[model samples]
Target: MNKGLLFSCLLVAVTSVQAAPISIPYQGFFQRLKQVNKGNYPLVEIAFSVPNKSKCLIKSGTITTETESFPLTITQDQRIFLPYDARLKSDRALVNLDIKGSADNCNISMQVRAKNTKQSYSQKELLELQAEMNTMLSDMQGFPMRYFSQDIEGINFEFESGSQTSVKIDGQRQVFTDKLRLSQEQLNKLSVVEFDTKPLVISPWTHG
Candidate 1:
């Protein structure tokens, strides 16, 4: 969904909460503890959390999970609530975003695993993209700058936010934690919620 569309959706979600009567569940300590590994930073991984009482039906295909589950909606008011809390952590599903940061700063690159039908961005393409990225971030940080040095003889660069799946745009890799900091308008424009939970390692992925 584009930024505009997402903003609209959020508006609608908020409206729904306000119009209806909702209640938060009183789950025990174990219940609350179950939501710990939501693939995001900060133990509670809810981006925009909406909890509920007893239970509710989740439409088919709304998520990729094989089974259906419900924890609760945390709001009783009319405002749309993204899961910023942990009470319903176990009940929520995730949309991961991966990111990496350079010590020098001035660039934001995302790691896109596949493009069209190809498996990884090529080395030659990366250089060109790197040049373009420098241009994009230059204006953001003020004054011109260069990459932090490709001294990757063994410089394992790894930093991740939510699930660790990053998007490779213009040869850069960015995580959800980074993206979340974007303006709500910017986030609404994003659509590729990468399911990247690989922990942003320098090497390949392995199941946690």
Candidate 2:
């Protein structure tokens, strides 16, 4: 069992469920990137854990980078929200971040216009995405056979002619094809994803 646990994405999905509203789990650390559109739809990518079976809802969270800042909010109903145009105007957009605290901590950085085009997931769909990514990553890089580690290394993607490497920030193997202007529909059968040249990565813990 290489993936005994799935931290971030699964937490978001489970929390969204009416029966499974998320509660902060530990005083540890976690990281995730979330996307929310004006429609209130959310897409999540995480490298950490939520308060497993605890009693806190992610009303909102944010991350700051050298050039930008990205904040995420989850409504009581668990709708993820990110205001991008608002972030672009800010001094620092999140380049990378990590969460560490006695409270629930999850790091997230918004990319590709947090609102440009968000894809929401049904419970089944969200689980499918996580399963798909995990399976693929195991094939490409060979994940650990016994357990999953909180710190996922070498999960970034580099474009052929691009100078920057876009870390898939989320530990899963799937990529964002539509965001890359690639053919998402045409590759319906393939599990591979492409990253935008403008990229982000997973860092360590931030006390906040």
Which is the leading candidate under lDDT?
2
lDDT of 1 by residue, 181-202 (tens): 2222332344322223422222
In order of listing, the candidates' clash counts read 36, 16
Per-candidate Cα lDDT values, in order, are 0.26, 0.31
Local accuracy of candidate 2 as per-residue lDDT tens digits, 135-155: 333332222123433222212
- Candidate number achieving the greatest TM-score relative to the actual structure: 2
lDDT of 1 at 166: 56
Which residue ranges in model 1 land beyond 4 Å of their true spot?
1-118, 143-208
